[model samples]
Structures are given as C-alpha cells and as structure tokens.
Target: MSELPVLIYDGDCGFCTRSVRWAERLPVRMRILAWQEADLAAYRTTPERARHEVLWVAPSGRVFGGAAAVAELLRSARLPWPVVGWAMSAPVLRWVAERVYRWVADNRSRLPGATPACQLPPEQRPGHRHGS
Candidate 1:
C-alpha cells in the first residue's frame, strides 16, 4: 500500500539479512521489509512465494520476483547501480543473471554471513532430489 517500492526479503536467513542491510545503502527511496513482517496479500504474493524468493513491489503496482526484483531495485538506485541494472535487464544477460541468482539462493548457507538455517533442505536443494 505504499507509494514507494517495497523490497521484501527473508528475515530468518543470516545471509539474506546481511544482504538487505547492504542494499539499504543504495541511493533509492524504498521500504525494505522482511517477509515475516510484510503484508504479502497486498503485494499479491503468498508466504511460500515470499519464502522462496525476494520480491519488489513497485509504486505502479508491478511486482518483480527473483533476479528481476533485484534488477528493479538497482534500476531505482542512482548512477552506477542503474548501469548495472540495465545490464541485468538485457536479454542474454538477464538469463545468465537469473541462473546465477538461483544458484546463489540454493547455496546461500555456504556463503559468508550465512547460518545453517540459510541452507535449503537436501530434498529442496536444486538437483538433489532429482539426483542431478
């Protein structure tokens, strides 16, 4: 219901929390709320959706998820960030960015600042259940 963009991120993951804190320094005016504290219904998102990916809700009522949401946020930021955002929005680069984002999300617990809970369950991890 806010007139500004809203960045919805996972609160329980230490890596996510750290990343959000870093993102707060971006030169953009937006509200950043943890998914646990957000009104998901207002953003046309469900708890499951929020749990799985970051979301960006625009003032114009557009909702972007995953890497696109990140790109949107960067686009709203100033100067160099917007340049990076434009690169992410490009066709081939966007495809690569999406894949990279998903890989990072799947391996977050192995990343710096991550806690054990940041790791996806074995069954839920990419290629684990499918035996890839």
Candidate 2:
C-alpha cells in the first residue's frame, strides 16, 4: 500500500525477534511488524505462512519469502549489504543460500539470542527423533 517496504516476522520466535531487531541497524527504510500484530491478508500471506517464514513486501507490492526475502532486505540496505544481496540472488548461490537459510531456521533455537520458545515443537523440528 504505502511506499515503504514491510518486513513481517514471527513475534513468538525469540530468534526471529532478535534477528529483526538486528536488522534495524541496516540503512534500509522499512516497516517491521510481527505477523501476529498485522493483518496478513493485506500482504497476501496467511497466518500459517507467516509463522513458517519471514516475508518481505516491497513498495511495488512484490512479496518475497524465505531466502529471497532476506536477499530483498539486504538489497535495500547500504554498502556491503547490497553486494551480499547480489551474491545471494545469483542462480547457483541462491539455491545454496536457501538451503542454508532453512538449516539455520530449523536450528534457530540452538543459536545465540534464541530462547526456548524459539524451538519448534518436536514434531515440527527438523531431524526430530521419535521418543528416546
């Protein structure tokens, strides 16, 4: 709607929250909101989709998800970020980057700044072991 980019993320995920906060230091002028606090229908996203991945909505109404969203955010940032963004958008690199992003997201609870709440439920977590 507006001429500003919107970054939508999961409010309940401590790791996601921390990552968004860290993104504030970037030079991009954007609005950051938790999907829980926003009307996702306006962005063409469902609650389930928002809960599963970060989204980037451009001023031109383009929507990007997952690693692509990360690339768009970086592309809007200043200096070195744009370079990194370009690399991530490269054909071969984009494929690898997406996988890496998924891996990190799946293991986010074990990362720095993550809280227990950031951990996905056992059934949803990657490589989850059934019982002990």
Candidate 3:
C-alpha cells in the first residue's frame, strides 16, 4: 500500500529467497514481501498465482508476472540494470525470456540454494492444470 512498488515471491522457496537476496543487492527501492505474509487481495492477485510465480505489483496497481516481473525489478535498479531490463522487455527477447523464466520456475527445486519447498505444487504446475 506504500508508494513504492511491491515484489511478491514464495517465501518457503530457498531458491526464491536466494534470488531475492540477489535482487536486494541491487540499488533499488521497493517493498519485497513473502506471499504468505502479504495481503494478496490488496495487490489484486490470488495466493495460488503468487505461489506459482514471482510478481511485481506497481504502486498504480499494474501487475507483472514471471519474466515480466523480473524485467520490472531490473528496471527499478540503477544504470546498466535498467538497460538490461529494457532488453528483457524487447519483442524477441521478451518471448525468449518468458520461456526461460518458465523453465526456471518449473525446475527451481533443482537449482542452487533451492529446497524441497521450491518445487511447485502438482496442481499448480504447467500441463498439470490450466491458466497462467
């Protein structure tokens, strides 16, 4: 509800926490919150969606998910980071980035710093259920 943008992620996921730590290292000003503790309804998002992917909720109420959320986070950082963020949002790159993000999200439990909690719930996983 503050003026700063809000970033929501799976708190139980060690990989997600580690990724957030990396994001925190960047010189960006925003609110980073765990989905379990946050009021998802305030962000106009559902718990299921928040559990499944990283989210960026703008102060104005716009929402970005998956790789798009990553791009927005980078855009909030300083200098070269914003450039990288712009590239991520570029047409062809956005397509590639989205797929890469999905791959990472699907395999996060196998990634470094990950814990069993990093694995998505079977019902929330791609192909196992519908909607994004």
**What order do candidates take by TM-score, descending?**
3, 1, 2
- Supply candidate 1's per-residue lDDT for 14: 83
Better of 2 and 3 by lDDT: 3
- TM for candidate 3 is 0.89
71 Cα displacement, candidate 1 (Å): 0.4
Selected candidate, larger TM-score, 1 vs 3 = 3
Q: Summarize candidate 1's per-residue lDDT along 1-132 as a digit string, tens digits.
A: 689999998877788889999899988999998877777888888777777889999998788989999999999999999989899999999999999999988778888899766676634533222321
Best by TM-score: 3
Candidate 1 wrongly placed segments (more than 4 Å): 120-132
Model number with the top lDDT: 3
Query: After superposing candidate 2, which stretches have Cα over 4 Å from the reference?
Result: 120-132
Which has the better TM-score: candidate 2, or candidate 3?
A: 3
As a whole number from 0 to 100, the lDDT of residue 98 in candidate 1 is 98
Q: What is candidate 3's lDDT per residue for 3-112, written digit by digit as tens?
A: 99999988778888999999999999999998877888889999778877899998889999999999999999999999999999999999999999999988889999
Error of 3 at 92 (Å): 0.5
